[model samples]
Target: MFGYRGLTISDDGILEISGVRCDYLVEKYGTPLYVFNEEEILNRIKEIKENHIVKYGGVAAYASKAFLTKYMCRLIKREGLWLDVVSGGELYTAKSVDFPMENIIFHGNNKTYEELEMAVDFGVGRVVIDNFDEIDILEDILLKKKRSIDVQIRITPGIDGHTHDFIKTGQVDSKFGFPMHDESALHAVKRILNSPALKLKGIHAHIGSQLHQNNIYKLEVEVLAKFISSIKNLFDYEIEEINCGGGFGIYYTEGDKRLSISYFTDVIHKAVEECFSRYNLRKPTVFIEPGRWIVGEAGITLYRVGSIKDIRGIRKYVSVDGGMTDNIRTALYSAKYTAVPANKLNNKDEEQVTICGKCCESGDILIKDIKLPKLERGDIIAVLSTGAYNFSMASNYNRIPRPAVVMVNRGQDVLIVKRETYEDIIKNDL
Candidate 1:
């Protein structure tokens, strides 16, 4: 079980995360507040190590797409973990925090010319290349710069992860990576092997995210091992790394079940060790990118309940000050989330209400038919497990301002990301 340290749930049902009460955060930062637990984030990193670090010497990188800030980068970096950056903007953020270039692994299926050029110039440690086009792009850039770039070719591996189809990248039909059955993929491997300007270092594959089973990853490793082995035999070449890609799921709702980090580690370890021993394969350094599990449960989004209307013939609507503009998962993925009355902490459960966002779209529903204590205008509601995709995916829809993000550690709470103002929206406009 993932336990939240420095937090307590009072008998009155009030939730205090990292010594800072959710109610207090609402009062201080206003509605649509994002509260993060500093300790819990680190704890997740430790969980990965506890569960799997010993096997083939595993290393973990916090997937920045899950939610990123300079301080968040520093926190993860300080804990001695690597980072996975997907774009130039994310890479720029990592650089802003002075993240070590050697520890950053650049990942993207369609990296732009400028992004690739910038990464190479910046000297990023590893580039996780997705397609043959990208292979050509990187080689072109390296030839021009007269520099050799360390690269990892991403293979489809045909592993359809048990998650939303849109987010799964390992399936053959997906937009990411080279498909295994396609002869073009073998040609891609040979191309990388022959390219003197690009050093082909490894194979990368992401099974998917929000995954619930460890066996899925076990199968991924098994398949990846065979893929790498075949490449070695065919090309007489060897790479030194195997990036498993991160999609480890965190507990969202009470009914959600996730494997312990140790269990996840053991499964991968057994798979890798067995394969290498059986094939007499050379062991390569293992890398994983876990995003949500690190920060999802550590975050709580606090929103102030606005007006409440009971439509007798229809469903009751309790509008919040912010909505899909700030956290679009509900509207986008039909993603389910849990919420509680932050201000009415000690109150008993008394109402079933549909929590809607202030976004103009009716699809801006946050939680549908959520049970809560008797609600009042101005009361604050805290939504749990939003640390992953909320801020990273927030948009200016309805022209609403983005919410602030804060880190709560020990008894101190500090703002890490400030809420956007109306001026921020029109800054780029004429």
Candidate 2:
């Protein structure tokens, strides 16, 4: 009902996703299942390709931090989009799939020496240098290996994004990149220019996540363009690429203002053209790394209602088998979401109820004060727009094994990840 493709209500009032009944999925995959619509994901990617990549000759990299799997790696590769990995584990996953290491852009704030070695050894396409210490570590590794790698310096654009404070990365006081008003960035550039192993290709900056305004990105471009011009004047070197990291917002609840892919891309492309032209600099190759936009709306979490508690004149609590461990955004970022009764889609009896998880923490509520069909024990509840961070950020808190992940498309379903077992939880215990 929130406008995800392939979602419909059956004649019998059952909620169907991609031509498959939600109850059938619960029967097969069990409670607390992570279901993704494969066609919806591809459509999002296709939209990026058409609006940003093809229209402006830019690169679209899938930010793997939002969600990553061996299957996801293969899917990204097959779609002709680049992969953005921030840790050695992500790199290993990509390597396991042979996901074209040259198409990979390695990113991390504090990349360990071993991870840098792995990136260098595996011949990753680009390493986004976050700090001066990382530059030194990577230079040392490259010197020891006698190999050169293309690199980009991540700069703090000093622009605060219109998002939560926890997710803001491009602010001046952030720990992510070199600050614009300081000499550290310039010093790092000088060091990289002298180092034979590190090739400084360009600059990158990601303001924040869940960004809604397009003008904010335009301002980021203007700031980076001015910096690039100053760099050319000082070092006489031209930057070949400008990586404008992605935070395009998606529809989660009715209150969220969702913009089209073109809404942001059009502004970004125009800003790059105008600003770079004004600075008299050559137009550089642009790269955008989108994680949530491509996957958020395509995913839904199915939880079977377990318990119902009603307090007279106060509130009603509908507990599910899953909670913060399965989806932590509600507790972490105070994120909002929408849901529906999969089995009672057409039910007329509705009541205001609070949806909560099975975790022991009282703050582990998923949705608060939402109106839904009068719920009962064993009812199937499907929460929408959980496709991005739910599976990737899931944990085994309270020894609760994580749920399986299923991808549905064109009336077909396949389990992409297996549900964790009790033994799997403590398999590393001595």
Question: Residue 224 deviation, candidate 2, in Å?
Answer: 0.7
Writing each residue's lDDT as its tens digit, candidate 2 over 1-430 gives 6666668899988888878899999999898999998898898999999998898999999999998989899999999999999999999999999999999999989999999999999999999999888988999999998999999999999999989898888889998989988788888888898999999998999999999988999999999899999889999999999999999999998888767899999998899999999999999999999999989988899999999999989999999999999999999999999999999888988999999999989999999999998999999999999999999999999999999999999789999999999999999999
Q: Per-prediction RMSD in angstroms? A: 1.8, 0.8
Indicate the worst ten consecutive residues by lDDT in candidate 1: 1-10
lDDT of 1 by residue, 268-365 (tens): 77888888667768888888888888888888888888899999977789998888988888887788888877766678768789999887787989
C-alpha positional error of residue 323 in candidate 1 after TM-score superposition, expressed in Å: 0.9
Q: What are the lDDT scores of the predictions, listed in order?
A: 0.84, 0.93
In order of listing, the candidates' clash counts read 2, 0
Q: Residue 43 of candidate 1: its Cα lDDT?
A: 76
